[model samples]
Target: MNKVIRIFIKDSTLIPVISIVLGLLIGALIMLLGAYNPIRAYASLIEKAFGDLYSIGETIRQITPLIFTGLSVAFAFRIGLFNIGAEGQFIIGSVTAAFVGIQFDLPWYIHVPFAVVAGGIAGGLWGSLAGLLKVYRGVHEVIATIMLNWIALYLSNYIVKFFLIEPGQQRSRILSDSSWLSSSWLSQLFDGARIHYGILLGLICTFLFYVILWKTRQGYELRAVGYNPDASEYAGIHVKKNIVRSMMVSGVFAGLGGASEVLGVFHYQTIHSVFPGHGFEGIAVALLGGNTAVGTILGAVLFGVLTFGATGMKFGAGVPIEIINIVIALVIFFVAASGLVKAIIDKVKKKIISGGSSLPTSQDWKKGV
Candidate 1:
């Protein structure tokens, strides 16, 4: 019984599962209130998410950037920084990649990686700018990053208009064929799939982030510094340096995500309507994932599925897809107040373990503080 209790308390994946399940349960309640059949609605939702080739491809496409964004947010959170500028960083990364993607013509093998890596570097620099201001000048990242986002939005628009613009058009010229990631490179098994090799890049990055956070010395120091910076300073960790570096890493992850969207989905420079909600979505994903690499990826996929399925819920049952956002909000609320949920669950689990007996009286509960 103690072992089971400990496993429930310590298993990282269990909490996120509970959060998601609770969110879905609450969503069903909302459906019930709307006079819609909740089970049927959910069934339709699943069908739409995986129904056909095009649906599956689109689902994968939507999930691609999420993996990067989720990891980006998760990485920053581990260092106690709230990186609200992921949207800006993400757009800048894409803009940088687009410029590089079209500026020079090289072999596909060389150009693709070059464009992608350049995007990451550009994003990292952008993120570090905020980090630098935060650490050196005592400016809050939340404020600085948000301001930078507005600057980035306008800058991206101007760049696309003046430099990358196609003569008189809003968009740049089509990227060279060599720079494109052809679906033909995939085997006939996924023959008509629009899912590209960018998915592989995201997955590889996720794994590397996992190793960095869990198996490396730097990871230990990062968590320590985040938890108690004063203590970490006394313990020889450079808290400020770690803060800046972590944010830079966060931006790189976001940048890579932007590249995935541009190279895999857009294929050319675009402006006037750069939708960056995905970067903001990563915040919810990170919260749900509990800031672990594996957990973050799972959270990203779950969100992708939710977003994918919400459209069907909207069209089929006349339900607003915004309800999905409500569900996410509820999950964040509970996770932020985790102590309450944990205490309640502990009471139920203890009761079960004791075969319905009451826990020891208060007078008998002096084992540990």
Candidate 2:
């Protein structure tokens, strides 16, 4: 039993799972304090998220963009950078995709790919601006990214207003059908749940993220730079270039997410006074996922379920949806404080080992047979 406990404690994957469990338990406690039945609330959440085909399809849709943004943040973290500007990149990508989708007249094969790629490129460029600022002007990426996020937001709204707006609407013109990523068959199957091909793209990107980070020479250099920049520089790696490239790549993931939202779900872009929050949520996903491709997907699924099911708690159990937000915040807090949890576990392990292996005292020796 001691050996089993030690082994379980050593497994890093268990940390996130434990954090989630702790968060849920604390949330339940809070609910009880508020005179709410957490069990029924959670049951309603699950039922709303997965009860029928339509619910499942919508949940998957929610998961799809999260997968992209999670990958974006995770990829940046692997390179020792914080990409706080994914919101900006996403906006740029969406606007770029909208432009292409509205302006281009081509077959579905060409239009779809073109519009998506355009969005990615635009986002990549937008993200690289921060990298460039960091490398050349000595600006920290966090500050640069935060500033860039506002710029991207305002710029996107301007573009919508001047070039793409549909007459009196605050949204851009609808994309041409050729550029749409929606699947008629899938929609029908899900009973008009608005499912699309973007989820498939998200899965493909996850696989690519794994391959690029684990199986490529460039990945090695990026990881090396992240581990020790001076050592990487001494080893002939161009750290500056890699930094810029990493940010660009990170932006591409976010941009693709934005494009997916436009082309697959909404088919139009809205002028927003504030961020859509996907990028910020992505940070949470990345942390929960431990910055791995598969982990990000799982984290995205968890977040999707929680977010989509918040409505169920509201309507079925008469619990305030704000409680779910509190639960999510608690989850993040637990994840962030995982080092303390590890310390506690280590203390227990030491006590167990010490108790099991204490030297026999003089009294014990005299009493021995």
How would you encode candidate 2's per-residue C-alpha lDDT over 253-292 as one tens digit per residue?
9999999889999999999977998888888899899899
Clashes of 1: 0
Give TM-scores for every candidate, taking all chains together and pairing residue i with residue i: 0.87, 0.91
- The true-versus-predicted C-alpha distance at residue 67 of model 1, in Å, is 0.8
Measured with C-alpha atoms, the lDDT of residue 363 in candidate 2 is 38
Q: Over the stretch 1-369, how does candidate 1's per-residue lDDT look in tens digits? A: 487765554525445667677888998899889888778777777887888776787677678888988888899999889988888888888888888888889988999889899999989999999899999999999999889888877888888887788887778777776766546554233436567777888899899898887789888888888788899999999988998999999999998888777877778867757566878888888888888887788788888888888898877787788878888787777676665555555666676776654444222322321
Could you tell me which 10 consecutive residues in candidate 1 have the lowest summed lDDT? 360-369
Clashing pairs in 2: none
**lDDT, model 1, position 57:** 72
Local accuracy by lDDT, each model: 0.81, 0.88
C-alpha lDDT of candidate 1 relative to the true structure: 0.81
Span of 10 residues, lowest total lDDT, candidate 2: 360-369
Count of backbone clashes, every candidate in sequence: 0, 0
In the order shown, the candidates' Cα RMSDs to the true structure are: 3.6, 6.3
